[model samples]
Structure formats: structure tokens, C-alpha cells
Target: MASGFNQKNKQCSLQELAALVPDGSSIALGGSFLHRGPFAFVRELIRQEKRGLELIKQSPGYDVDILCRAGVLRRVRAGIVAMEGNFGLAPWYRRAVERREIELEEHACASLTAGLRAAAFGVPFQPCGGLHGSSLPELNGWKCLDDPYGSGQKTWVVPAIRPDFAVIQASEVDAQGNVRVHGTAHWDRIMSRAAGSVLVVAEKVVDSAVFEAQPESTLVPYFMVQNYAVVAGGAWPGSSWPAYAIDYPAVEAYMDKNSDLRAHMAAAPEAQEGNHG
Candidate 1:
């Protein structure tokens, strides 16, 4: 079990957190496009020059694009990678897929979530009817199995996706490492439970008593969190709702300057020191 207060006192740098993730490990990122993602941590991962990471997510944005462009990823299993609204497609991700730079596994969002849910419960697989009559099963090698009980109905069985690590950004975390997600949590909760290890970046950290005062707000208990750190504005450029809104101008600037990805990355704000515990 993780020692909550002890871990809270031993906060390390973001670099140290990034270093904890080894090369070639499958990693699940939190949030949808431009919403509550750990963008700063993704930047640190790139800064550390990590490589051969396998990324898993529902819908990704700049976080995954940066990693893909940095040549840090070996494969990506995602439902989609659009920029949401009028932002259209994520340019770098689209280019990477077009160029075949990284292997891609496209699964339906429901199937992907189901797989993670199964993993969280320590199940081998989850049966779903969502992929029926779709090419995804054949494309991703999902098995179509028949129901054993009298009914001859078939279901697509999505294998569990237990990642090596899950990195999530939260609205708040108590000293005991209980996380609170203010808005739509996306897949963070399930991914945290499904991964072998979990790391969280929070906009604020308060006393454990705060959670005790409002227990329903605690989305992830301390036992599920292996490590956590308070990183104000940690999501930067991506919105961490109820705390900060999306940096639209910054995103626009990024889109305009995206052709020089390395240069833009080099100019990104430095991550804070105390980012891991």
C-alpha cells in the first residue's frame, strides 16, 4: 500500500516522475482533446527524451501529437484524434498516421472503455455488441464469440488493456493522495484502476480532512494512487474545468507555430520542481 502522508512529503521533480516510466511501456493518458490532460507531464516526458512508448487513449489532442512527433511513441491505440469543434483534425497525428510513423490501433470508444473497465476489475475480457458489423474487430483482431447459453448471438470480446502506467491530471488532491476531479473525468478513474501504477498531477493539494468533510468529491482513493503532486496550472493550454478554462489563444498560437514542433516544444513553459511524491 502507498503511504499517503509519507509520499506527500517526498515530492520530487516532474523529471523524476517521467523517469519512473520506462521505455516501451504502455501508457494511458487522461482526458479528451484539450480537456484536463496532463500536458505539462507530457512535455516533461519529451524533455527527458523517453522513447518507444505505447499510448492508449479514447480521444487525444496535443499531448499525444507531441509525443508522436517527438518519435517517443511506438504505437497508439485510440478511438480518434480530432481537435474538437472547428479545430478539425489534429494535424501532427494525422500526418504521422499518413506517414506510417507509428503503428495505430483504432477501436471504438465504447470498446476501448469496456476493455479498460474489464482490466480494472481484473477480468480477461469484456463482451460487447458495439463492434458488431464493423471492420474494427477484424482490424484490431478482436474475437467474435458466440454466447454459451442457448442464444446463438455473437459478441465482440475486447481484451483487457491494463497499461503499465496511467498519468492523470486532477482538480484537487488531498495530502493523503485522494483525488478530486471537478468536471467530466473522462476515462481517468477507470484508467487509474486499470494500470499497474498511477501518477496524478493536481491543480491543488489540501488536507485529508477536506475529503472527510465532503467524501463524495473524492474520485480516486489514496490506495489507487501510487504517486501524486500538486502542480498548479498543470493542465496548461488544456482546460482543467472549475479551476481554469482552455487557453484558446495559446492553442491557436500552437496551431500556427506547429510546423516547428521542436522549436515550440523548446519554448514551452518549464514544469515546476515539486511534481512527484
Candidate 2:
């Protein structure tokens, strides 16, 4: 149904799309630290100045960083930042956390994955051993206790995170929003199913028959997607495959030139390199 509906029938614009999410809605974003990720839509959300939106990111990117900087996000339940390779070492995100600009509930990647998976599985919560001996205990409001068997072990049981909405990008999706992903799919599958609502952006729109040809390859079914958009260069300035190239020089320029997300969001989209023709 997501594909059957057009821009007029569905919420397509970023402002209108953001309006669908009320204050205090928990959101899930799809992607790892980098590579193929969603950033354009995320930027638009921040531009609309959406408030009280809690975020759940399995592998956050500059998308998370911008939201935090714009002060639109109130709380974050994330595995790590898209930076630093280890978890999250984003310069802007780290600075905001250090300054107490936002509320944070940090967890390890495995635990974050389990949390979303639990939601997708329709479970209340999953028992996780992440953050056994780290500052996450005090920050996340989670109870970290010791073992009674004298095993000298510690564990932190993180509650499941079922999001109000999930936003993600895909290589290709049928008109009905049945998406297919290959090669380092990332947590896109879990995040899409775990949310009460799902919005997918695809580069190309194909017929449902294509998706049906390889049912197993369909990571997300149409029923789960409430809205879908065919957006080219949707993952701009970072990663887009086959269709376009990642504009890293522009991303770095945006990062260096703008101090706040507001300014960066207001700036023009980066012009692609080697377009002399």
C-alpha cells in the first residue's frame, strides 16, 4: 500500500512527514556508522524543528549528531555513533554529551540489536549483558547488579525499545514498498519491523513481481511500511550506490564550515564533483 499511494495521498514532504510524529515519539533510524545510510530525510526532520522526539539508533551517523545539535531530540537510545569505528566518537555528538545537551541511554551494539529485535519479536524486553562495568549504568537509568554465585560477573539488563517510527533508505523497493537489500544490510530489517510506523526511501521503484521473484530477499514487507518515497540522492553527501557517488569532500566541508546543525541544514546541497559538462 505504501507504493500504491502517491505523494498527494501520503505524507511525503519532510515537514508533513515530521508532523505525523507527535511530541515524545520514540524513533528508530537505520544504518551503521557510515557506508549506506539515510541522512537527507533526517536533515529535513531537524529542519522542521520537531520536538520531544526520542531516538533509537542501532548504528547512528551524522543524522543523530544533527538531531542532537538542533535540540529537536530529547532522549537517545543508541548503540554507538557513526564515528570512531569502535562505537561512537563523533566530534559534535561527543561535545554535546560532554556539555549535557541531551539525555542519553547508551548500550553496546549487541544489546542495542537485541533491544530492537525484541520489539520486532513482540517481546516486552530482552536480558542483555552489555554495559557490565561502564558508565552506561549511571547514564541509562538501568540497574546493574552483581552475580550471586560468586562468578565475579556483572550484567546490565536493558529494556526493549519499540519505536513509534522507523526511517530508512534502500537500494530498491517495489511500488508497494517491499524492500530488498544485499551486502552488509545493516540493522535495517530489525529497525523497520520494530516500529509502529515505517517510512522507506528508495532510489528506484520496481514492480511487486520483482520482489516476489526473490521473497527471501525482501527484508521488509509492504504491510509494515506506512509511507514510502522514491528519492534519488536521498543519502547525499555520504553514500549512494550505483546511481551516484558519495560526496565526502562536501560532507567534510559541511562539517568544518558549520558549527551548528541549523546552519548546515540551511546550506545548499553539495554540487557533485567533475561535472564540467
Candidate 3:
């Protein structure tokens, strides 16, 4: 559980980040839709022409669509995959899955979070009794088998998801990589702790003292942060909230223009640039 930013901060690049990720590696990502995505880092991945990464997003948006369009991702485990709306309907993802261009393991949003929580807490598995009598079981590929405990209701078991790495974006971070997620945190902390390694992209790096003075504001401690870089406008063309403004017109343009997932992915900037990290 080593903390703090890597010693070679300035020396690190998105290419180095790509080295930590491998083909078909399962990745848990931060943000909900376009909210807090590690856009610059992800763009760097696309720029590097990285490929074959597997992504697990609870609520994906352009980040997932862009990667898929770049052909950098091969598989996805997600609750919802779309680029439209704030946290719903990733048209690009839906198109890709429907066209059989990628493999998808879908689950309910709450179940996805619960499973991630179990992994972060070091649990072997999470019994999803909460999904009983819901459409989630069918969507997740779980059969309506008899309950062993005879609870009189079917139970779906969601396996723990311990991702190889979790990539996130935040409003601020100290030089040591202690992240503070302002406003809605979504599941940034859960993804950070559950993954084997964590990479964060911050808008700015403040003094370590600033973090220490207000420890409660720290959402993810440096202890869990493996690699961190200061990336301004990292979540640009999306929403970064108080740190920056959302590119509403851009988002709207993306939604209005693309009818299918592949087309949307094809339209992603990263796809043309050829990076996915």
C-alpha cells in the first residue's frame, strides 16, 4: 500500500501509462458518463495507438465510445454504455455490442457498484439479493436457478471485480498525488481502492500542505495512487464542473450527429488520432 505520487513525476508519460495496461486487461474507470473522465490520459492512450484494453464502466459516456471507436478496447463490463444524456445511453457502445464488434458483460447499476464495493473491501463475492425479482438477473446472464438457502427468492451472485488498474480524473491533487474530488464523487474512490493499481489525472497540483490542511476533502488518498499527472482541461469537451465548464454544444453535437455506436466511435477525436490509454 505505497502512497504518494511516483518519484519520477515529470518523467512519466502516457506511453509509460500504456505499459502498465496490457491487451485484454480489465480496467475500472472513474466518472459517470462525461462527468469526471480521465480524458487527456485516455486521449494519450489513443494517440499512442494502444489496443486490446478491456474496460469496466458503471456509467460510460464518450470516454468508452471514444476508446471503442479507436479500436483500443476489445471487451467491456458495464451497467450502461452510451454517449447521450448525462449518464445514460452510450449509443456508440450499444452499436458496437449490437454489431458484435465487442464483447459486453452487462449488469444493473446498483449491482455493479455493490460488486465493486465488495472487491474494494476484499470480499470473494457479493450475493445480489437486491436484484431478485428484477430484470437485472436476465441482463447479467444469470439463470433463475433455485436458491440453495431456500430463501424463496432467486438470488444472483455478482463476482467481485478487482480490476488491474483504475484510471480517474479529479479537480485537484497534491504533488504527492492525494486527490480531492470536488462536488459529485460518483464512484472514484471505490474504483481507486478496488483496482490493483490506480492512475489519476488532476487539473492542477497544489502543495502537500493544502491537502493536509483539509484532509476531509481528500477523496482518494495518495496511498492508493500509483501514478499521477497534472493535466489541465483533462476532462475537456466534457464536464469538469467548477474546475471547468462542460462543452455542452460539443456534447450536443455528438449526440445529434451519430445514430449508431460505430458511427459515433468513428467520430471520436481519439479514433482519428489513434490513442487509447
Candidate 4:
């Protein structure tokens, strides 16, 4: 956790921020399904050829699908990976798993949250009885233990999943690294705490005075943030609440199984200079 102790301006370009992700690193993505997920950053990873990444998210769609198409990800840990309704499944993700090109470890949303919470709490594991009647515990080999209080109840505990980094998309961020999220945080807060460090992708950059005036509104205090980038439309194709909504046409093109994503990749600035072939 970088405490912004020096009060340094943590801003950088999208390429600079994405470069911090190592090949084969385990990274947690903020947002759920199609909303506010960092698709722009994912594109940069593909362009940089940051291969063998393990993506962790509660729900993901376009980001994971495109990563799979680019052969950038080797494994995925998530509850469910799909395009929000009407678009149906994340076609590329399904195809990759079906072809055995990617390893998928599925979990219930609750189980995943419990695992993240445990890591954020600085604990090795957390007990959860929510997995009952679900095969996730057995499939993932989670440990089942008896309560120490003699309650005669068994609790299933999941191992902590600490990612090397957590990438979050925020509505606004100050030069000092303080972030303000206009809507639901989803699991971004927990991921920030559970991760080795946090990288924020913001839609707008405001002055430090805005934060000092209302410190309580900061969703991710500068202390938990390590680095950040300001891209006006950073969450493109995904909704950045209070600013914009999901872009349906872009999503449709992405959902089209025939698309090679070369066109889409060429459109993003960070990927334009790199060879997408």
C-alpha cells in the first residue's frame, strides 16, 4: 500500500501505468461485468505483449474476452465471465476454455468476496458457510474445518487471493492520487487493499483543492493508491457512471465472434504505435 506520504502527483500516461504489470502476473480488475471495467488498460496489455496474465475479477466480459483473443491471459479466477444480457456469453472466453487454451477456476461471487476480504484483512483464510451445496469448495480444494467454539458446525474457508496489482477505473482523481468514485465501488476497495499495489485509471483529473475541501468523498484515499493515469474516456465501451453509459455499438462489435479486434486495437492510442498483428 503506497501511502502518498510524499504527496507526490501519481499521474502517468496509460502506457506508463500498464507497463507496471509484469508478464505472468496476477492482477485484479475493478468493476463487474461490463461496467467501469478497465478495457482500455487491457488493450494496452495486449499491445505490450504482456503475456501469461492471470485475471481476477468477480465478473468480467469484454476485457477478458479481448485478452483471450490476443493470447495475453493464461488463467482466469472469477465468479462468472459474460457480457451483460442481450450480448450473451463472452464468446472468446468460452472458446478459449473449450479449446483448453485457458485454465478457468470458477467461484461463487460470495466465495470470491470472502477470499478477497480475507486478504484485505491481512489473514491467511476466511471461514464461509455460503458454499454449501455448491461444488466450488471441492473443485477449488478449499479447506473445511470445525468451529473452535464447539458449535459443532463446519465452515469452509477459502485461501487468500492476493494479486500483484489491482487496476481501478475512477470517475475523478486528483493530482495527489486521491480518487473519487461517483457510484457503486463494487469490489474495487477490497481489491485495492488485497493487492500488492493499486493503479487507478481515471476519466477526469481535478485539482488537489477539490479533495481538501471534501476529504470524506474520496473513495480511494491517496494512501492506498500507488499510481494513476488520466484518460478522458478511460472506461470507454464501459460505463463510467455520472459521466457516461455503456457504449452498445462498441460492445456489439466486440461481441461479434468474427471480429479479429485488429480494428478496435488500432483505434486506441496506446495500441496504435505497437504492432497488433
Candidate 5:
């Protein structure tokens, strides 16, 4: 957890942020598909060589794939894992699952969101509809319950999915840890609330006055952030909209040369966000 709920000034280096998640943690990643991911923070986690971690995300692309390549993940709970059109698939993630090197517990997009909502709302479970005619409900151990008011309709109840941490990418976060995310927060609010703690990887760390002047822009409040790091272009090779777009060439090159990650990363400085606080 964070130092304290009331503790201010959560800014730290990427390494310090990564240190908070120990081995065997079940971590929820922010962003959807390839946009606005905490790639820089993910890189630090790999560099630190954290092992036996469980990844939880509704949709993941580069983050899950790289972790699979690094042998950092033991299990994954996600609805979809793939690189978009620029790249057809997350090859390393596919290979790992095919090789039975790790475990996967899949969910539909709605089901996963229900689970997060359950945890965030401090409920035992949340009722989910639209999962009919699918095996995922049974496969995921979601219980079936009859509608209470004698309506006789049945729904799936997803047990609370409380991850150890939620790591998010932000457009900006102030020294006090108030976060601002410009485009496509993409279930980040629910993910943050559902997790035990939150870590933010930000494009810039600004002054608290910036947030005070525009409180409505604060997507994540100060108390919710355990720690954060300032990394310009933190989401590289993936888009952090209004700032940059997906680096498809870099991504394709990564798929080809990932076996030599050190060499590949040397050519893409934004992948590691440089070694600065």
C-alpha cells in the first residue's frame, strides 16, 4: 500500500514504483488495447526481474506480450490479448500459452468489468448479464443466481476480483499525486478502485496548482495514488493520444528482435523512459 492515505508528494523514480509490487503479485494494468499503457513502468518491472506475477487486464497488447517474453508472468486474467492491425498478434504471449508455460483465466469484457466493479463497490459479487450461451461463466466459476424479487431471471455473479495493484499511465500527475488523463481513461477509474493500491506512470509531474486550477481534469485523486514516476513519452510504441501515435515500425521491429531485448531497447529510448527520477 501507499505510505499513507494522507501522505502527499508520491512522486518517485520508476524503480521505486516497481519495488512496491513484490513477486507473486496479482497486478491490474491500465489502458485498453495498445493505448496509454504504462510501458515504462512495465519495463522497470521486467528489469527488476519480478517473477510469478499474475496479470489482470480487460484487454492487453504490448504489456502482456513483453511480460510473457521476460518470463515475468505466471498467470494472466484478461478478455483479449493481441496487438492491433499494425501487428496481428501478441506473438510471445501466444507462444507462452501454447507452450503451457503459464495459466490463463479468460473473461468477457463485461464480465471482467463486473468483477472490478464488485470489488470497487465493496460487494461480495456483482450480477452480470449477456454471458448466456458461453462457457466462460462456468469456466471462470461465476455462480448463477436467480433474480431475487421472484422475477425468475438468472444472472451470473462474478466474485470480487481484487488485484494487488493497478498501474496506470497518466497525461500528467502533480507532486501531490493528482492524476490527469486526457484521452480514453478506459476503465482505469474502476481498475484503480478495485486494486489494493495504485501506481501511476506519467508523461510529466507538474505542480499541485495545476490540478487545483482544474480539478475536473483530475481523473485520479491524490489519496488513491500510492506512487508515480515522471517519464516523458512513457507509453512508447503505443499511442498516448494528443502527444503521439503508435510506433508501428518500432513494434514490428520488437516482434522480430525481442530475443535480444537489451539491444532492441537501446534503439528505443522511450521504451525505458530513460533512467531519471
Candidate 6:
């Protein structure tokens, strides 16, 4: 049997990592819209022709949009799916949901994060005070229960969302598979622990000893990472924080190239291969 340390050191190619995710699996993607998502791994997934994936995210941008455009998603559970700031909505995702081509389970960002937290803690559900008066509970099938300790107050409880796989892109990862995220962790940290399998793709890979110098920088511990890959510009077209900026022109060009869903699906594999390369 492989030792614990050796198991944690399971580094592989992007294609090999993508192959671990079976079709129809529930997948949680790291990053909040335009930042630090495993874009290269996602591209590899598309190339490998996996389909019927259930996507979960706090706020999705290219990662979710591209997958939906390629007709790989069967359902989406997210707080929101849009290009942050001036970019507006993720066109493909909006169209798919609007056309009833894909099922959507929406929640407030905090609720989604809370659910992942619950999963990470191995709990049945997590209660939040938010969404008490909103119709989101009904729309998304979340439950509202009376607070046992409060003065007859109702609390909305979100069920745990333990996905089959969690794919994340980090600023750096050490040889032992400890991942580091420079800026915001978003929901990646919790999501990594919430998933059955975790894959970390890093902009750079360093020696395990590096973490000894600054342990606080280690965001995702090695035990939580099942597979790791070193892919430069792994989060291409999206910002990876302190390391690189979002490739706005590339993103715009991609959006323009795949504006038509039918055409994009027909040529997705070839187009994405070139894009990733």
C-alpha cells in the first residue's frame, strides 16, 4: 500500500486529473467568478468528453459558462453565475437556464458557503439567519426551521453539498500537495474538504520545505488533496491573484468565438485544446 505521504504526493497531468471525474458526477469548482478556477483542468475535461456534470459554485464565470456551453452540465447549484463588475451576466449560462436546458438550484452566497462548511464538518445541515423572509427557500427547496434557542425566530437550514470532486487552482502548491491561495479563498478551502476527491492545480509547485518557512500560507493541507498538477497559467483568462491578472482580451475573444451554442458545442474540443495550449 502507498504510504500517507506518498498518497498525498500523487501529482499527474491535467488530462489524468480530468479523467478521474466521471460523467454525471457532482463537481464543485473553486474561485469566485474570474479568479483562480481550474480552467486548464476544465478544458481538459471538455477535451475528454465528460458530460452530465452537476456544477456547484458560489459565483461562477468562465469555468461554469464554458462547461454549460459545451453541454457538459446537467444541473447547477450556485449563488450566482455572472461576470463580476462590468462584465454582466454569463451569456451562455443565462441562456441555458432561461431555456430550461439545465436545472438550477440557486441560493444566497452565504447559504452556499454555509452548506459547504457543513459538509466539511460532516454535518447534516447548517443553519443561517439569512433568507428568513425570502422565497429562496421555497424556490431552491431549502428548509426553514424555528430556532430552538431563539425567541420563536425561524432559521433557514441549507443541506450539505458534498460533491464527488472538487477542482481548484491555487497560487502555489508544495511537493507534499499543500495548496496556497494568495488573495481571497472564496469557498475553495471549504469546498476542498467537502468533496470526496480534491484536485489542486497550481501556478507553480515548490518544495515541501517551503511551508515550514511560513505555515500560515498553507491554505489546503496535503491530506485533503488527492491529486495535484503544476500547470503554468492554469487559471488563464482568469486572474490567479498575486501571481497574474485576468486575461480580459482572451476572455472576450473566447466569448466571441463561442457565441453560438450549437457551433461552440460542435467544435468545443478542438477550440478548447488550442485555447489551453
TM-scores for all predictions: 0.92, 0.81, 0.82, 0.93, 0.94, 0.89
Give the poorly placed runs of model 6, Cα more than 4 Å off. Answer: 1-9, 257-277
lDDT of 3 by residue, 118-229 (tens): 7988886666666766776776665445678787866567778888999988888876667887889888888887889888877777777787788888888876778776
Comparing candidate 1 with candidate 6, which one achieves the higher lDDT?
1
Best by TM-score: 5
Please report, as a residue range, the 10-residue window in candidate 4 with the lowest summed lDDT: 268-277
Worst 10 residues of 3 by lDDT: 268-277
Residue 87 alpha-carbon offset, candidate 5, angstroms: 1.0
Which prediction has more favorable TM-score, 4 or 5? 5
lDDT of 5 at 17: 89
Q: For candidate 2, give the lDDT.
A: 0.69
By lDDT, who's the top model here? 5
Off by over 4 Å in 5: 1-8, 257-259, 270-275
Ranking by TM-score: 5, 4, 1, 6, 3, 2
lDDT of each: 0.81, 0.69, 0.73, 0.84, 0.86, 0.81
Model 6 scores a TM of 0.89
103-173 per-residue lDDT for model 6 (tens digits): 99987888888898899999999997668678888897888787788788778898998999988888888
lDDT of 4 by residue, 140-234 (tens): 99999998999999999999989999999898888778888888998898999899999998887887788878888888888788899877666
Rank the models by lDDT, top first. Answer: 5, 4, 1, 6, 3, 2
Candidate 2, poorest ten consecutive residues by summed lDDT: 268-277
Question: Which candidate model has the greater lDDT, 5 or 6?
Answer: 5
- Which candidate model has the greater TM-score, 2 or 5? 5
lDDT at residue 182 of model 2 (Cα atoms) = 49
- lDDT, residue 188, candidate 4: 91
